[model samples]
Structure formats: structure tokens, C-alpha cells
Target: MTAPSPARVVAARVLERVVSEGAYADLALDGELDRRGLSARDVALATELVYGTLRWQRYLDWILAPHSRRRLDDLDLGPLVLLRMTAYQIAFLERVPAFAAVNDAVTLAGRARKPGVAGFVNAVLRSFSRRGATEREPRPPADLVEALALRCSFPTWLAARWMARYGASEAEALMRALNERPPLALRANTLRVTRDALAARLATEDDIATLPSRYAAEGLVANHGGSPSAWRAFADGAFAIQDEASMLVAQLLDVRPGDTVGDVCAAPGTKTTHLAQLLDNRGRILAFDPQPARLNLVREAAKRLGVTIVETLDGPAEALAPKFPALCDAVLVDAPCSSLGVLRRNPEVKWRRTLEDIVTNAERQHAIVTAAALMVKPGGRLVYATCSLEPEENEDVARRFLGAHPDFALDPPSEFPVALDADGFLRCRPHQHGTDGFTACRLVRCRR
Candidate 1:
């Protein structure tokens, strides 16, 4: 029996973590890659395998279901994931030959399971390989939403909701856009380097090609390189890897130097550090999140970027709101959301999320925003934001906040109105903005 490719082995192992253990794909893949020490070529292959399999999981299952004797979901996790991994390569990854993919899957299955399991995998794949693309491909359902869901590998319920909200054509465009890889967006740590200077260094020194983001002054989109963390500029805190839309969210706070800011629900402190940068590292930033481990990421980023203004807080925003009532010049509630807006970055989310998760997060978002509202000084801006395309968590949450507290009103004047929807709430869609599907509404507390 031929040996399986180590890259395939690693990809399958990480896929198991993501599927069975609920590990984050990006973090898990990074950890495995560092431990395995795969070459750049195989590393890229493994990375592609991990993400692409997750991205097209629904569609790959559709392809495999008819070929399998047992239900795909009922199958053992190991064989189930290996089958999806192999099927993804055979169908979508053109560079990998079908025979090589099938052989590797068979080898992997044999190593993990009884003899019958290996035979089962080989028979299923050989039959799958012979059937070819068009033969195995299902006819698009008569319902446009169903067709879109199956075609784009989305949950039917999610596709249905999106189609109803965005209409069929635009929803399909959004799905297609999210299925592809997003650009590597980096925020130039203006505390240290100007955007232009950093771009020049990335090219001249690091040999990484780059382009300035059209939306954010401080944002640079790196084309291709090894991870940004490996770059000397990143090590020196010259830039922070943040989405262009997320960069815009922090900028919306418009906090000036020496002003106090509150980052309610802040963790993994990407925006916390951005607020500090915008504040010229002179003002105080009260950052809060429930988990210490996630807060550690914020602290590490702050230290790396030379940001000294951030002050981390413990407990939920509502519990801590009493400590600083009307204390900040600006407050940012980067609310915990379903993260439907960032599917390209976290493709596993499409599988993991349920409709109830959407509803529960929306309710939690409203409570957090209301609590954060109390901490904003009168006339100060309370920026409510989420990486969620869902209205219940986005506009509805903002609107509900306004209903209970008439003292707070929506503020429409923004640096990036192009991302604003017809109703004036900021809506960044992957198809339209080439960024995550972020929705932000800026609310200003009345002076009286």
C-alpha cells in the first residue's frame, strides 16, 4: 500500500478537530503547521485542503451521499472527513490528480480503521471517480433558494433567509464571493509606520506585493506572502492584520487624542489596539471581555504595536457598566455575533451556526449595547458594531436601543457612506465591499 501524503494527513487531522472538537480552523491549522514543519509547497496544499474542504462541505456531501451506502453524517468521523477531503480535491482542486487524491484517502483510511473500512473507502472513491463530474452532479432544484444553497454549499435555511432578505441574485453573488479566498488585509500600525512607508518596506525588504485599500487610509491588502506574523514589519509592530471593514469600524469611533474610549465586549483586541492607535496612544481605553485567553491576544497585540492606553476589564459589559457611567468620550460595542458576515475567513461557521444561535446572539447584543450605552458620556458617540449580516443583531439591535433610550440617536455621517445601506446603517457585504459582511450603526447620546 502507498503511503499517504503528510500534508493530507495533517489536513485530515485538523479537519477532525474542527468538525468533532469545535476547534477554530485558522488557529488549529496554524498550530498544526508550526508543529509539523511542512515545506512551503505542502504547507500551502494543507492550508488549501483544510479551508476548501470546509468551504465546499455541503456541496461535497451532496456529491458523496448518493455514492455512499451509509449516511454521511452517520459514518465514523475519520472516514467521513477523509472522504470529504478527498472529494474536495478531486472535484474542486484542479492541480491535484484524482488518482493521487483517491489513493491517499485509501491509505489514510487503512491506517485508522479496520480492513473493511479501507475497502469501503476504496470502493466508494473508485466508483465516485468513475462517475465523473456531470454524472454525479445533481439537477438544480426548481426552488431558486434551494438551488443556490446546494450550488454554493450553504445551509438551506441560511440560503433561504439570505435570499428573502437580499433577493435571489444578490444573495447568490454574496455566497459566491464568500466561497472564494479573501485578500490578506493588514492595517499599518500608524503609531510606528505610515501606510505608504510600510507598503514600500513590504515590497523592497519583504518582497511581498501589496496595494492600498480604497476604503481605509491605513489599510494595506497584501497579495501573497508567508503569514504576516513571519514578516519583520509585523514582528516590529509596523502593521496589524485586520480586515479593511473592521479597520473602518474602529475609525468610525473618531476618538481624538487624550479622549477616553470604552471597547465594550472587546476581546482578541484587534480593534482595541486600533482605537489606541487612533487616540495617539495618549488616551485611556477601557477594554472588556469574559475570557482571559482571548484577552491575552489583545494584550499581546497591544504590546507588539506599542499601544499603552488599553486597560482590560473583567466580567460582562452589563455587570461592569456601573463602574464608569458616562465616563468615555466614545464607546465601541463590538458585540459578540453569529459572525455570518465573515464566512470566507471562517468557513466552518456556515456548518456550525444554527438559526437559534442567530436569535440568541441578537438578544445578547441588545443587552450589551444597552449596558455600553450607559457608559457613554452625554453627547459622546456610542458606536455599535458586529460582524453579522443579520438584521436582528445589526439594525434591529440598534433600533431597539434607540426605542428604550430616546436620548440616543443614530448618527449617519461616516467616513465610508459607500458601505451604508438605504436605511443609513453601515452594511459591508462581501460582494459589494470586498470585505466581511459587517453591520455598524453609530449612535450619539443627546447632551440634554
Candidate 2:
């Protein structure tokens, strides 16, 4: 028999790491790809299999559970992962022939030293294929939470939360949208080139197709082709890869040249650099993060993008609040969150996170926002943002902060690409806006 595809083998290994070791899928995939030295096409294939399998894991499990004589959870990790990978290809990935998918999975099982498991895998996959599995849609469980969870490949608790907040129809739509692959969006660095100018240059030099983002003025959606980072425009600091919804946060902050801004959690510097670009690289930005290594990433990105105004401060955000009380013209509390909004890009999040994480994140967010509040000048602006769809993390925290700090009132952003709630907070949903789910509430500190 022909050897199993190297891409499938790599994908299975990555999934095993993600499932058994709790490793982040992207990092694990990157490490494996680098070590394996796969071709570009193979790399893309492996990436799709890894992400797609994870994205539809719940659905795959639902189908496999009924087929396996042994409990799926009780099976060895290697065999179980192989089964899921094969099921994904059989049920969803039409480009992969069913026979090849089944044969590859059986081959992988034997290679794992479980020759007995190979027969079991062949039987299960052949059963699926013989029954015309591609045409069969599993019936939804009677319970709404369970049904939506299985149907959309989300955790029951998460599905329940969305249903409670958005009603069943909208929640299903949101979950369906989240299962899709997000377009790669790049923000043009106006300091180096305009959006139109960069798009022109990319077409001429890289042959990468491009389209303007509906909301973010500088945002461009790469239509097709290789990674933009490999292109010369990226090397020249022409743009930063960022979601359109995230781009809105810096825009709402409205930093002007010479403004003193504070980024409370500015690691990896996506927004920090955007702030510099908006300021024309002439303002002072005190970027703070708890981790020194992550802060180093911000510094490197700033150097690459030709931004020189940001000063890195390596310490917890809360500690800095006391030292520079009211020192910033604007402060961004981009608090760590449960990350429910960016699920399309990070599918593992749906499986890894729990309902209790929402509460935990909210508690941490409350403290961070409270501390960051101290850095904004009395008459200056403060924006609290998160890539989360949860009300507790978004609106409730904003409300609680307003209640405690009477000096700060919701300012309600006037100009943004996404829709605003009645309270004037910026809210973008994956289904509605085709962007990562994000919420930002702008507040103006009352003058003493």
C-alpha cells in the first residue's frame, strides 16, 4: 500500500499534542512543520487538516461514538486521533477520496504499533463509507444546548450561553459563522504607504489579490496567494496583520500627535503599533505587559514598522497605575478575556475554555481596568476592549467600572466601522460583520 501522506501524519501528531498535552494548536503545528521540512503544499494541507479536525471535533466525536464498540474516550490517544482525522476527511473534506482517507488512517494506526487497532479503524471507516456517510447528517439531540453544541461543534455550555444571550436562531447563525475560516486581514502602515498604494504594490510585486475592508480604512483582506509576511512590502514595514474588528479599538482611542497614551496589555504590539501609526510616530506611548519576552516582541515589531515613539515598561499593569496616576492623555485597557469572539481563527478555544473561565476572566478584567483607569488624565479618554462576546466580560464590566469610578462616563464612539449598541459601545459579531467578535466601550474622564 502507498505510504500515508506526510501532511496527514503531521496533522495527527499536532492534534495529539493539542488534545493530550494541552498545547496550543498553532504553536504545535508550527513547531512540527518546521521540524518536518514539508513542502509548501504539504504545509498548507497539514494546516487545514489540523485546524479543520479541531474545528469540527464535537461533530466528529458524535458520529464516531455511535460507531465504536469501545468507548471513544477510553481508546488510546493515538488511535482516537487517527479516527477523528479520518472521520473529518470522510464527512467534510470532499477533495480527499474516502478510500484514500480510510486507507491512510489504517496505515497510521499500524505504524503506531497498534496493529490490532488498524483492523478496528478499517472496520469503522469502511462502515461509514459503505453507508454513504457523506450524505448522512446526524440528527440533533433533543436538548437545545446539546443539539446546537453537536451541530456547531461547540461546547454545550458555550452554546447555551450564546443561546441565552442571542436567542436560538441568532446563536446558531453565530456558531455557524465561527466555524468558517477567517480571511487574512492586514492593516496598511500609513507611515510607510497608503492602503490603496500598498494594494497596488502587492499586486505588482507579490501577485497577491487584495480587497479593502468594509470598516477599517487601512485594513486589506488578502484574497489569495501566499503569506503576506513573505512579501517585500511586509519586510519594509508596510503593514501589520490585524483583524478589522481589532483595528477599530485604536481608531476609537483617537490618539493625536504628541498625545501621551498608555497600552496596559501591549504585548506582541498589534494595537500598540497601530497607536504609533495613528500618532504619526511622534507621540509618547508607555507600553506595559507583565511578560518581558512578550514585550520584546512589541519592541521588535516597532523596529520593523519604523515606529520609534513607544517606550516599553516590563511590569504588571496594576503596578504602573500608582507610579503614573493620570499621566496619559488616553489609556487602553485591552484586558485579557475568554476570547469567544475570535473562535473562527482559534478553534481550539471553543474546546479548551469553560463557562467558569468567563467569570474568572471578568474578575481579572475588572481589576486590570480599575488599575488602568488611574493612568488616564482626568479629561482624557480611556477605552476598554476585548475579543469576547460574553456580556459579563463586555457590558457588565463596563457598567461596574462606571459605577465605581463616577469620574469616568461612557463616551460612546461616534465613528466606527461596526455597529454600536444603544449604549453606544462598539460591538462586532462574526456572523453580522464578518470580523472577529469584539466589543469596545470608550469612556471620557470627567475633569476635576
Candidate 3:
């Protein structure tokens, strides 16, 4: 028997981790690829298969449901994942021939320890191949939410919520935008190199192209011949991978030189380092997070970017308000969120997050933002931001905070470089702005 293709095997293992163990897709795929030592082309193919299968799993399950005698969820994990990977290639990846996909799936199934599973896999894939193996358009459902969910491959509840918030046409656009592959956006480390200088350096190098970002002054969208991380510029800390929308958040904070800034929930430190750059490395930034390991990431980022003003603090972020009341000239609360806005990068999030999770996240965001508000001095600025399209975590939370705190007023939209809603909030959507969906509100505290 022919052995399973390396890409298919790697994809299946990564999918198993994502689906069965709830492991993050990016992390799982990276670990597997490192261990397997596949060629770059094979690694790319494996990545496409894993992300595409997960991104379209709901739709694939709908197609598989009619063919399988048993429910897709009830099938053994190995076979189910293999089926999804094969179906995704047949439907979406034009480079992969239908016969090859089926053959590889059967080969993989035969290797599985279960009896009769290989026969079942062959039968099912052959049945689809007989029908021309073309992706059939989903029939419209009676309910708008169901129709959107099925067509766009999102959870029904999330589709329903978007429909309610954005109306039908707009909601559909948002769903389509989220389904696209996100651009590789990089932020030029100003302390080390200017944006244009970095772009010029990359252009001079072999097989890399870059375009200036529309909104962010220090941002570039990279089109690479290979991994951007492997570039000499990256090793020299000329740029850090960050979405243009996230770079905008640091700019919105307006941290000036010699100011004292607080970054609550500052894990991974993309924005924290940006804040230091905005300060020209002159201001002191207290970057706080509950997880020490994540805090260490902030420290590492700061060091790599040549940012020296950031001080990492390990503790619950909320606890900092009492320890440093009215102590900062500016505070950034990039709260934990469902991250619906970043679905293009992390497709598994759509399947894992529930509507109830939104409410729970909103409660936590409100608490953290409240704590952050206390750290900002009178007449200082406080920016609340999230990578979520959900109003419960964005506008609703901001409104509730305003109702409770009379001293804090929404800052003018002019404070931010990006376009803003009439209510003075900066809301960037992927469909409209071509950036990750982000919402940020800048508030100023009045003298008590």
C-alpha cells in the first residue's frame, strides 16, 4: 500500500490536536512542522489544509452528514479529521486532484488501528468523487441567521448576533471578510529603524516585497518569498509582526515623553513596546499581567525592540489600581476578549467561542477597565481597546463605565489617527478597513 503523503499526515495530526485536545491551531501546526522537517512547500500545504479544514469544518460536516451512516461527531476522531482534510482539499484547493485526495485519505485510514475504517473512508470519498467533487453552493435557509451561518461557516449563534447588530447585508460582508487569510502586517521598530527605511531594506533583500500601511505610519504589509521571521531585518529587530489595527491602539494612547503609563493585561507586549516607542523610550511603563510566563514575553519583546522604559509587573492586573491610584498620565486596557475580530488568523476561534462566552468575557473586561480607569490621574487619558466586534465588550462596556464614573468623558475622535464612529469611538472592521476588527475608546478624566 502507498504511504500517506507527508502533508496529509501532518495536517491530520494538527487537526486532531485542535479538535480533540483544544490546542491552538497555529501552535500545534508549528510544533508538528518543526518535528517533521518537511520542505517549505509541504509545510505550506499542510498549513493550508489544517486551517482550511477547521475554517470550513461546519460546512464540510454538512456535506459529510448525508454520506456517513453515522453522525460526523460520533465518528472516531482519526477518521473524522481525515475526512475533513480530504473534503477541504477537494472543495477549495484547486491544486490537489480529487483522486489524489481520496487516495491519500484511504491510505491514512488504512494505517489507523480500527478495523473496516479504511473501507468506510474509501467508500465515502469515492461517493463524493463520483458526484464531480465540486463544492456545492449551500441552499438558503428559512432563517437569516441559519442561512448566513451555513453559507459562511460560522457558528449559528455568532451569525445571529452579527445579523442583529449589523443587519443582513452588512453582516454577510463581515462574515466573508473574516473568512479571508489575514495579511502579514509588521510594525517597524522606530527605535531601531524607520518604516520606510525598513521597507527599503526588505526590498533590497532577495524575494521580499512590502507595501506601506494605509493607516499606521510605522506599519508595512509584507509579501514574502519565505517566512518573514527568517529575514535578517527581523533578527536585527527592525520590525515586529503586528496588525496595523493593533499598532493604531498604541498611537491612540498618545503617550508622551516623561509620562508615566500603565498597560493593564500586557501579555505578549506588542502594544506595550509600541507604547515605549511612542514615548521615545523616555517614559516609564508599568506593564502588568497575571501570568508570569506571558509577562516574560513582554520583557523579551521590550528588549528585542530596544525599548528600555517598560517595567514588567507580575500580578492580577486589577490589583494594580489600589497599589498605584491616579498614578499614570495614560493607561491602556487591551482587555481579554472573544477575539472574533481576528478570526481570519485563528479560524478555530469561531468554533470554540460561544455566545455565553461573550457575556462572561464582557464581565471580565468591565472589571479590568474599571481597575485601569483608577490608575489614570485626573486630566489624564485612558484608552480601552479590544479585538472584538461584539458590542457587549466594546460600546456597551464603555457606556456602562461612563454611567458609573462621572469624571471620565469620552475623548474626541480626533485623538485617534483612524476614522471613528459619531460617538467618538474608533471601530475598525476587516470588511471596511482591511485590518483586523478593533474597537477603542479614549476617555479623559476630569479634575475631581
lDDT of 3 by residue, 99-156 (tens): 8899999999988868999999888878766655444543567887887798789899
Candidate 1, clashing residue pairs?
A: none
Model 1, 1-448: lDDT tens digits are: 7778889999999999997899999999999999998887788889899999999998988888888899998999999998999999989888899999999999989888586888889888988888867788767788887788998999999999989988999989999988989899999999999999999999988899999997988999997677778899999999999998999898888889999999987889899999999998998999999887888888888999999989998779989887999999999999999998999999999998999998999899988998998899998998899998898888888888899999999887754635576787887889988998888878899998
**Candidate numbers, best lDDT first, in rank order:** 2, 1, 3
**Residue pairs in steric clash, candidate 2?**
none
lDDT of each: 0.89, 0.90, 0.88
- What is the Cα-based TM-score of model 1? 0.97
State the lDDT of candidate 2 residue by residue for 1-448, as single tens digits.
7899999999999999998899989899989987998887888888888989999998988887767799988989998898888888888887889998899999999987855889998887787776565555566678878988898999888888889888999999999999998898999999989999999999999888899999999999997465566799999999999999999999999889999999999998999999999999997999999999999999999999999999999998889877889999999989899888998888998888987898889999999999999999988999999999788998999999999999999998665567688988898889999999999999999999
The lDDT, on a scale of 0 to 1, for candidate 1 is: 0.89
- Model 2 ranges off by over 4 Å: 133-135
Order of models, best TM-score first: 2, 1, 3
Q: Choose 1 or 3, whichever is better by TM-score.
A: 1
Each prediction's TM-score against the native?
0.97, 0.97, 0.96
